[model samples]
Target: MASESSVWNTCNYSRDVTFFYNLVGKKISEEWSTQDFVVIGLGLTVCLIVVLANLMVMAAILMNRRFHFPIYYLLGNMAAADLFAGIAYVNLMLNTGPWTRMLTKEQWYIRGALIDISLTASVANLLAVAVERHQTIITMQLHSNMTKRRVVLLIVCIWVTAIIMGLVPSTFWNCECDLDDCSTVAPLYSRRFLIFWAVLNLLTFFIMVAMYARIFIYVRYQSRATSEHTSEIRHNQTVVNLMKTISMVLGAFVICWTPGLMTLLLDGLLGKASHANSFEKYCLVIAECNSLVNPIIYSLRDNEMRRTFKWILCCLCRKGADQRRQPSVKINSPLSEETLDFVQKSEDRALRKPQDSHDKDGWTEPRV
Candidate 1:
């Protein structure tokens, strides 16, 4: 009976080995075609667009002193996150190589770590922005007290936390899984890793959703109370912009994260199957693409960003044109009559005597 059991176990092992090898061999035998090239081109295009868009956002915020406020700082952080994530995705797609070349185990591990860090950073930054917006809108008193130092501290903390989260797989677990053509060795979902990620993602998502919802409510109420047309229009525009920002963040979060979360939950509850492997990979790729979509959405939806980008481009073009036309043009200064009149008015105002506040208060000697 023991011999028969050994034979059965050996047969199962052999079958598993055979199946894995077959899958790898089939993938190795496959050739890259025009369809594959198209896919690669599309992915590259997305990466390029995302990188450029995010860089433009960062540049606009950095170059414009008017945009140095806390809100733009938050936006800058988000753009930074998107830029990193997009670059990481591009690296992954490019490293996969054409046709028959498979990624090395080391490359897979590195890419996995990078993806984890980038995605985690992107999510955390979004949450931070939502929280900042909430405090400014709902808790007006607190917003006045919030300093740039505090915001910088918060951003630092976010990156630290994200880095720690990403490093866990590399530090504690064996992230060496051999797939057919692609391989990933992420840290096994041990209790510690599972608890950490689950808590992190859930807490961040919940807080952002709640904060954005409150902001939306407050903005709506304020908009209804205002009677001036221009004021109302401005307020309405602000509310719309805030709503759009929050919606885009939430939409990307859901699209990128929901599939992975569902897959993890399903795997825990109902074990894994061979067919689910491809589905999981597809979901992961889709989720990673979320980082690329964010900047595109911002550029498309936000007028301020759009205008700033246009302005920057226009300035560059004008500068180039001026450089080419430099020798032909000579500057001559002429004072205008309006400028002289303005100077005279300024001088007249300066010559006038200042009124004392006490004189206007009408305190007379009889009162004393």
Candidate 2:
């Protein structure tokens, strides 16, 4: 028997968006079993991790002066976007879960807008990072001469374009269907809009692949410094590291987002979202999980990032053996004294070198 309040049976658009979905095949929150609650708990856990990890990266970047250059600048923007994405998942859980009736149209629209911003900003910032790396590598400049004004312009373009692409189209999501009983299930925009969005993502992905490929080829196959064995070896090593980083970034992006992206494409192609609600929900969760990935990749591979993270967090709590032990007049032996002096001298000389952050080529900035 159909529930009188169910959207499909009643043919009502005023009902909550969740009214149409068969929630995990159960009737309502009252009917959910222990396993359902467990699933909800796990989803919440993932969302929390995504937010905290990305926020940590953003905080580290903002507080540290060394990461002020273009690449790290782009990374900070990416982290901010991911952080927002993670927050959106919380809103999704509310809208799709038992509390869905509490969601308003404005809230739903904002949720959609946030997701769009997160995705587009992520893609744009990453592409910018790759392009910056390519520019520096091929030109043999440790850092590009990107001015502050140019960087601001790029940032503005990224956000503005993302808004137009992701949020503008959502304006049509009125959820109206039949005159008496309109529904939210219908696509607000045409199939072409969906295709266009997916195509833009694919286009960016392919461009990155091509850029990385060229960078690899140039670094591996051609080098004018071949006669200088040390220079050639160093150059090749730098390029290898760059390629590895890019590969990991691109790989994570594909792994995390491909499932939902494929679903979106199929929907556009078929004019229907054919997958089960459970399956589609999980696929989207997987895509949102990408929020925490780039920061993890960055912290593991970049020694400097690790230091910066530590530096940022250490102020909160300081724990060491120093407070436990009483100071004594312990004189250093002659050899120990000499070692200490040598270390101090080396550190002093290193401080004299401009731009503490740089690649092997002595650039003033570090790559993302």
> Which of the numbered candidates is closest to the native, going by highest lDDT?
2
Clashes of each: 2, 1
TM-score of candidate 2 against the unseen true structure:
0.74
> What residue runs in model 1 are displaced by over 4 Å at the alpha carbon?
1-35, 97-104, 140-145, 175-199, 225-240, 268-271, 318-368
lDDT per residue as tens, model 1, 142-249 = 122467898799889878977877777656543123232122112233323443565567677777777777777877776666646553445355545656665776
Clashing pairs in 2: 177-182
Q: What is the lDDT of residue 178 in candidate 1?
A: 23
Candidates' C-alpha lDDT: 0.59, 0.63
lDDT of 2 by residue, 184-231 (tens): 222333345555667778778889878988887776665555636654
The deviation in Å at residue 106 for candidate 2 is 2.9
Q: Estimate each model's TM-score.
A: 0.68, 0.74
